[model samples]
Target chain A: MNTITHYSDEIINAFVDGELAAAERRELLAAAAESDRLRQRICEAVQLKELVRGAYPARSPEGLVKGRSGRRGARMRHAAAAAVAVLAVSVALLLPRPEPGQRLADGALSPVLPLSTGEEAGETTRVVFHVSSADPAAARELLDQVELVLREYAAGNRPLKVEVIANNEGLRLLQQGRSPVAERIRRLDQRYQNLLFAACGNTLERLRRETGEQIRILPQAVIVQSGVSFVARRQQEGWAYIKV
Target chain B: MKTMRPYTPFLLLLSLLLAAPLAFAGSDDGPKHKIVIQVSSDDARTQKIALNNAVNLQKALGQDNVAIEIVAYGPGLSLLTSKSRQGKRVESLAMQDITFSACGNTMKKVARKTGKEPQLLEGVRVVQAGVLRIMELQEQGYAYVRP
Candidate 1:
């Protein structure tokens, strides 16, 4: 028996799954080349997994008609196998649905307040508002609604740590200190200690060419990359998402 | 007094067990703790390892403690396809709550050349590019390792 070189869990699992990339597979193959025993160990682990799965019966007797006569058991097995096949096929046909990721900084779409508000002012909660629009007026209106809601929530003692994430068209809201709704936003920010700003980097690199640099973001605004992704990150961390 | 005595030790042990994981889990200081997985190669072997590492990370540290993202661009994007070679791995990791982001730029470029949309593996989400997505994820506090 040959001594096995140390292996990380990552490498070992990859080895078991037979998923090492060519270079990695080659590296492992070369490393294990000296040890037939190590190779066998990896193979045994993979084999053991299959055996363990096979160890369990795929169907439970409960699902089958209990009092069925002898012939039905065989037919039930066949039906179950056929059902699994159909299920596999349907799963294969299913396309990926975009459920937004947590900590959404990319402006990915996520749930806002449920149509019906659930909890009442339990405590001050951090909330992120995703704003994206090509039209300046609409973006301003979205901000207005957010301000109104934040103030309403605040009156109930639920202070909001509000971050306005403007990406793509929403970048207009943070134009170089000249957003059409700047004063209104700043007023709320000052009153509430809220952060109102553009994602400076995402805005400059992506939105700059589209809207030009002259667009004013309020002086208080700090820029970050991918406002949508930033918000996504926060949402993932359990901050409820609102797109107003 | 009799009722309280029976419950006290049980509650104490439960609290200790519950607190232990959070102590280990919440410490951000351990390990340069970043993983960046590349799914660019269409090879099933490589794709599988990339996903396995993702699962292991989530297992070792709760998913919230560690950030994971899979970037698939170019030929790697095919790994995300339901019919593609590595579809099963894509599906498995998705069930474990790992995020699979596909490359939009690759789709656009490939779709233009192939005259058809590049199919994304059933469970993968579309992002701008595998590399770009990695960069984005890294910026968002994920450690990067190209497995």
Candidate 2:
């Protein structure tokens, strides 16, 4: 059986630097498309690169920033000598050991320079949450976790999509009148334009049999399917999975 | 019983010819397919490829049939930079229709650490929630690819 292969640092770095030919790049992409591990590694590498760059914004080359490369180079030389020991210690502690197949964003030989932190400006994202459970508290707890995650991701503009699919016992939170979680869910929905709630029809049938009136799901809940299947299908479809 | 079964063979022949064309015509719309590309990284190199692939897919499927998105979190937000770095590739990608996304949580962390906001490039859109964004897109039936 063939083992799941990861991209080598050289290949990954080459690909990242846009140095690879079209054919090679396509091949690498094909390889990445076929492997989840590769995708994770690539994301990690990219993140590492961005972090590095953000942590250490490249000082404009002497001539570029101030039109004096050699002058700045001489000062950097003296500065390097003084900071060498400290830099080495920090590098050893901070940089993870490069695994054999680990792909570095810049490549194996790329300089290990610290990134300046000033470069980071917040970026926007869209997100959706899936909630399903019989217990209103548990369902609420799931939404709390989701909110926490979203709080971290939204930065300020709150650019995202958040959807909650409640079915079966999960339908209790989304009913129009008697649903306990209705107000809270609706408030979130209003604040987050991308937020939505889906309730499952299959679960509603069972609820109707028991309560005769559709389990009083909050208006915020949109019917879909049982949460587990919904999450599984989503993950299979390529969405990131968070158990909470 | 002695009525007429002569038309049975003729009817069968006619049906076969008509059905033959339908079989060829229906299957030619291409196979039902889906793909997902992972965009959790903000590396210049990975972002470029991710954007290129999105474009390539758009070209192949005329943009509508293919669903393309970039999901960035953590340091991956840097790829959304509209400026050039040591290399000039990222700027070019921003010009493309490629969507660059950053993780809200990560940005907040960076902002706190640096006391500066991360620059969101021209084509970049922020998805305040990374995991949720992925879930929504998946819910919408998009294939995931981590390039």
The best candidate by lDDT is 1
- Model 1, span A65-130: residue lDDT tens: 122221111223467766765554455346353211221223222121111023322333555667
Which stretches in model 2 have alpha-carbon errors above 4 Å? Answer: A1-147, A150-244, B1-36, B42-44, B82-96
Best by DockQ: 2
lDDT of 1 by residue, B27-47 (tens): 756433555566756677777
Worst 10 residues of 1 chain B by lDDT: B131-140
Per-chain TM-score of chain A in candidate 1 equals 0.45
Per-residue lDDT for B26-136 in model 2, tens only? 656543344445554446777667767776786887644544566766555666544424124444444554445666766776789989877765556677655556655
lDDT of candidate 1 at residue B132, scale 0 to 100: 37
Chain A TM-score for predicted structure 2: 0.42
Q: State residue B51's C-alpha deviation in candidate 1, in Å.
A: 36
